[model samples]
Target: MAMERANLLNMAKLSIKGLIESALSFGRTLDSDYPPLQQFFVVMEHCLKHGLKVKKSFLGFNKSLWGPLELVEKLCPEAAEISASVRDLPGLKTPLGRARAWLRLALMQKRLADYLRLLITRKDLLSDFYENSALMLEEEGAVIVGLLVGLNVIDANLCVKGEDLDSQLTQGDVSVERDTYKQSRQGLDEMYNEVRRQLKEECQLRQDVENELVVQVSMKQEMELAMKLLEKDIHEKQDTLIGLRQQLDEVKAINVEMYQKMQVQTHTHRHIIQQLEMDLKIEREWRQTLQNDLHRERDSVAQLSTEALQINGLKKEFHRLQDENVQLKTICEDQEKALEELGSKLSESKLKIEDIKEANKALQGGQVWLKDKEATHCKLCEKEFSISRRKHHCRNCGEIFCNSCSDNELPLPASPKPVRVCDTCHALLLQRCSSNPT
Candidate 1:
């Protein structure tokens, strides 16, 4: 309807004009929390959403300005970054949130006007999302875009990731802004209503004054009463004014409290981000160290293979040890990936932390498995464990031995399958088994 266009155009003018004027007065970089800037975005959202076609899918009907905004990226290469940033922004779950954020980001980049201009020019593309009479499809859209050009002078720094964009719009429309601001400003709206009521009373008083002129003779007596009533009404109005002032003070106090809370929240978010970054860095360094350990282990394996003669019997154990080292390398690769994932998954970071601690403990040394460095030769045979004659562990005694000495397999209580045991332990177990006659 003509009325819709007219109203939207007027509001667009008001929002743009108001924002520019206020932002210039702001003197500093306008942040995401600026009031007039927020209102401007709300107005732009309304303009974009006007007469948007509802597309139905599995999730029910869907309407979002983001789809149209996405077209801007295709149309103009400069907008691609903004669109990508919006897509990657955290805490924004809905398409609408993305759309809202896209608008803010575009404004921050000072290309919002240019992007909108491109969009409006491509009516052929916008037609799918918006009706012909929609604000975006009409001259009103162009006018709004032109007005946005003035906003280029203003700078905005928005932390899109920190904000709860998906959390807005549940309470009401743009008439009220952010929820916290809305809660404080609710009293202001009540004050506005009181002012309107006061204006209506004044208008009624003027009408009565006009009627009194016609009945001057009878009005003489009624005028005294009317004057007395007017004086009483003035006192009541003054009392209302004082109450309004008190309410205004309360709202101002609430706003200050909310602002302080927001500052605290922002500081906390920065602290958390810094902590995560440090954690990520530490994880990366740990991963690098693990990679180094893997390389050294591989070098030791290579040296062992070069030294050992591949006898048919020794080849099997050699292959098994080779396969075990391969698994170790694979496990290290998987762990590297898990460490890389810690940056994005802060909640599950503690899982990787414990693993890191265990690795650190092992590096310092553990009591269970005899470290390879502790013994250069087989314990029982006194044969020097060379690179090819690789040292192996007897599962029962946790002592180092050459493959030939530890190759005998016997079932251990801890293991369901037969596992490697030293010759001495193997003999002791067999003798004990024969004596028990089980």
Candidate 2:
């Protein structure tokens, strides 16, 4: 049952699509003789017959498509026209013949899909003629009805009255027709879309041009009005200029008389000005001489003031120098006293050195004792002696040195306790004791 519905659905789709394309190509009009139109009717008849229930009547097992198609009139009032017309036909005796005639009339009215769609909605009424699985009673029936919507655009002008409606022509090569139909439909759609786009662009361009032209026209009108106003003002100014030129002529005549009078006065004034210029020249010479004397006096006064300032500055400098000399004399006197005290200490140090040398000769042979003033630097390190660097007497050698050079202590035969000695003297005494075994 499902397979039957599938086949019928596929057939309905191809036939309805190709028929709509060919109808559009033929300017939406088809006659009974057109091959695609005849094939569309045959496919629709097969779809209606598939899964149809058998009705036992006086004629035995009647399964005519006309029964369900007639139910369209009861479902919708608008189908009454096709119903009455089909019934009134002269020679449509068989239900199949009447059904075929009715389809043509309904298609001409452009309501074949509408009438069938209404009949399919009422399954209870359709059950009398079709089985539960009939294409008319299932979803396939509703789909085929929907595909008929495209056929509404076509005006099918069929005169089936004189023709035989009971017999139908077999379908032709629908697959090839379907492919050709697709290519043509695609090209037509593309051409229509391009034309619609170009038309829209042209409309926009025309609207822009019209708006610009309107603005230009309005500007031209404004310039014309302004030009007229400027010309009117120029005429008024030209009329006033004529009167101004007449008045100028009168003023020129009065100026000529005044120029003659000024000429006479100019000569008399020229002689008086010459005499006054001579007097001014003498006055200017005398004034220049007086200015020279004033300048010389001012220079003399400035020279005297400068000399006085110089003398005052020199006097201040001399007083400052005298005060500095007095202070320097006092410092010199203090330095002289310090030098005398150093001389006395030097003499006392010489006497002590003479006594120490005598004692060194009385004892074992030894080097001469160094006086305090004679040893200005340490003998070992050669550092200059200052007040902080005091002299030290070496017990073994009796030589004067800084405390740092004579810091070592060692026991000596002359002293019980350890005595300070120079680093050289300490080493010499230790070597002597180690060798002599006394």
Give the best candidate by lDDT.
1
lDDT of 2 by residue, 97-131 (tens): 88889888888898888988898889888887777
Give per-model TM-scores. Answer: 0.40, 0.39
Global lDDT of each candidate? 0.80, 0.79
lDDT of 2 at 307: 79
The whole-model C-alpha lDDT of candidate 1 against the native structure comes to 0.80
Could you list the CA RMSD of all candidates, in the order they appear?
A: 45.8, 36.1
lDDT of 2 at 20: 82
Q: Model 1 compared with the native: what TM-score?
A: 0.40
Q: List where candidate 2 sits over 4 angstroms from the true fold.
A: 167-438
> Quick one: best TM-score, which candidate?
1
